[model samples]
Target: MWQGLLAFVALAAMAGCGEQNGPEAQMAQGQAPNVKIAQPLAQDVTEWDEYTGRIEAVSSVDVRARVSGYLEKVNFKAGEKVKKGDLLFLIDPKPFKAQLNYAEAELERARAKHELAKNDLERAKRLFRAKAISEEEHDARSKGLREAVAAVQSAEANVYTARLNLDYTKVRAPIDGRIGRELITEGNLVNGGGADATRLTFIVSTDPVYVYVDADERSVLKYRRLGQHIGAGQTPVRLAVADEDDFPHQGTLDYISPREDTATGTVTLRGVFPNTDDLLSPGFFARMRVRGSTPYPAILLPDRAIATDQAQRFVWVVNQDNQVEYRPVTLGAHIGQSRVIKEGVKPEEWVVIEGLQKLRPGIKVNPERLSLAAPY
Candidate 1:
């Protein structure tokens, strides 16, 4: 009876092991992994080529005195907004005023001399006509009158120049802009009107700023082929400063270099933007993008959906049988979180956006349908 019992127990243990390794148990433990899948977003999209660029003022000027003088007063506060023609600095006007006074006095003396010569010439002309004076004497008086007229004109020019010098003593802003700190303070002697002129300050126009960028030769050729010419203002551009995530500023292509730089093989391009709020400033680093292609129908997938195998980018697509298929894709520019699909994926096919690590080609998946329009 003990021998029979031992054999029966061994058989029961073998039966239990078989049940544990049965197909039902395997099916229960190894169900297909759930994945989120959605059809590619289809829209008319324009590809934007991105570039790093620098912000520049539309107009920039260095403030300097037009006349040599002792600086009397710095009219503007350091780093203030000033309008065109606003007084920026004042030079000592006493010396210029004295020179102007002397010029006026000389003009008056020249006028008196001219009158005396004119009267003498008139008397000589009458005597010569009445045969009361020699012709030589009358000619000398006429010559004196001509010399006097020239002297008077010279004096008048001197007076005008003196006035101009006096006006130059008051330095004014040449353009509307935010001014830099005063470089030369009051009581300092400032030289003017040469290469060595003292720089008083600087001003850069704030509104309608410029952004300059360099584009590769291929990009420039593409733009030309699209019928866009230099300074056409037809090509639209968007800009974002270093602190911004999105391009909030809108501008137009204003300039393109006539020749490409031989060393870099790139062409310089400029865009003009209106800065009403004064947020954009010169010398700031910014990211700018231009519309590279015309609007066309494109299939878009979230950047997360894209996977890389060596150099090839691909995504997993779910077919009508709910089996994951490997699809290689060609990508274009990125639009927000989505990438443009130049080829490979179709608009109607669903692509796996989640559970990518658990997927294999031809594997069945529990697909949860998602709307591409909704946030991923």
Candidate 2:
């Protein structure tokens, strides 16, 4: 029984040895040298950042009626671009005029009473000196005169307030901007106390418009470290309308927010685009591009050349013998369709942009001469 067991173990060992020494196994080991590889390449890439920006007017205001009254007429067209002091809407001034007249009449009455009180006080002063009237009567008359003066002042203030209400009947454009649709039509009562009575509409400044965008703090910090001030005159912004194939107009940076947005944790940047022809409007989404200082002699690669290995980024670089080697690279911000290489590469090196799926380190490459084609 022992001899049969030993014979079975010997037969298994011999079969394993034969399989290891087979011709098929030897051929598979030598095939690693034939695999293709890529070399590092150079490219002129401009780094760009894409942020979802909202088009906003530099100045936006809501027009509201001050006095509670019926909207008599709308003077301007809805959605019309209006200038400052342009007539927007007119509320019925009949009520305001009546109140003004009442106030003015009261003021006149108070003035007449004040004149009478003054004359009476003067008479009391003269009579007191002659001892014809008691000092108490003189004091009372003097007090009455003072009270009459105060009443006159109060009436004057009321008249001024009434005039202000009358002026409120005419809703005028406070700023030069494009007016929105009127919220309340003629004969509709606008909220006197608040903007409820009539929504005169919104007016937003379209000329030298604002583009509000956000950038990650890290990217902003990186930009700051480069010692570039993204300010007006220094920073030129180019904008592309949603449907336009190309960016037609350029703008300047207007204002940068004092603090970063806490909710999104990004800095809010606003750029003012000149709208000479009034082509750009508020609430229209447009693609904004900002130029940064191009650090000349930057190393770059096509977008697909680099890949993440586990958690680290690495690229395949080919040597003179066409042998593939793995290289870890430090990546900077994306520039256009390519990437900016901060480290681990040099100029004039070929990089693998395509055919990277079937590639590994230490494999030989049969490099097919590729035509240097300009990117579309």
Candidate that scores best on lDDT: 1
Model 2, 1-376: lDDT tens digits are 9999999999999998887665445434654323323344455555555555768787899887788878899888878889999888888999889999999999999999999999999999999999999999999999999999999999999999999999988888999988888888888878775535445688998888888888778866654543354443456667887887556678765555668889989887666788878888888887887655553556666677788889888777777776667888899866655577788766555555666765677666655544333222
My TM-score estimates for the predictions, one after another, are 0.89, 0.71
Candidate 1 residue spans exceeding 4 A from truth: 1-29, 227-231, 374-376
Clash count for each candidate, listed in order shown = 0, 15
Instruction: Please write out the lDDT profile of model 1 over residues 116-148, one tens digit for every residue.
Output: 999999999999999999999999999999999
Model 2 CA lDDT for position 153: 99
* Maximum-TM-score candidate: 1
Query: What local lDDT score does residue 88 receive in model 1, on the 0 to 100 scale?
Result: 91
Q: After aligning candidate 2 to the native by TM-score, how far in Å is the CA of 363 from where it should be?
A: 10
Looking at model 2, report the run of 10 residues with the lowest lDDT sum.
32-41
